[model samples]
Target: MSSREAINVISILGSDYSIKAPVGEEQTLLNATRMLNATLADTKRKYPTLIGDKLLVLAALNLCSQQLEMKQRHQEELDRYQEQVNATVDVISRTIGKN
Candidate 1:
């Protein structure tokens, strides 16, 4: 981390946002906001009738839904990996105990 401040100001959905992150992570935060704004813009375009709270809620829900699915998949993979590790440890323990 640099001695310099790691905060950045960006525009998202017509609002100015201040994001604080590691020194080199300003671009990543900016990119994330850009993606979010894009999502909001796309949602607004598809459902112009929706406004204010409704539009924001829909966009947030869409992102959350995708995030949850990804988390579930990652959890499944972690569970499989843990099972393998446990099996290997058990085999090694038994072999050692028999000696």
Candidate 2:
């Protein structure tokens, strides 16, 4: 997409945010922005002392937490596969040595 075509203005919590995203991804970006605004509104309503930046930080932390969890799970799977490969290699080496 062209640079100008990829830029869209998103409204969140009554604020206008200019975001650069693919043309077809405007809906996805808008949806995510809406979700963030809802989350901030809910937090403010539940806790009157919560501020905008703090709510945004909390949301960022939650996203980071999800990413880390996924990374850890992927790493565990990679480790398991490596162990299986090592075990197979050891078995083959032993059989060839015996022959």
TM-scores, all candidates, are 0.70, 0.61
Instruction: Kindly list the per-residue Cα lDDT of model 1 for residues 1-96, writing each as its tens digit.
Output: 456558788986567877678877778887888777888898999999987778888998988998999999999999999999999999999999
Top model number, lDDT: 1
Question: Model 1 — which ten-residue stretch has the worst lDDT?
Answer: 1-10
Task: Give the alpha-carbon lDDT of every model.
Answer: 0.86, 0.80
Q: What local lDDT does model 1 show for residue 1?
A: 43
lDDT of 1 at 50: 89
Off by over 4 Å in 2: 1-5, 22-49, 96-99
Q: Best TM-score goes to which candidate? A: 1
RMSD of each: 3.1, 3.5
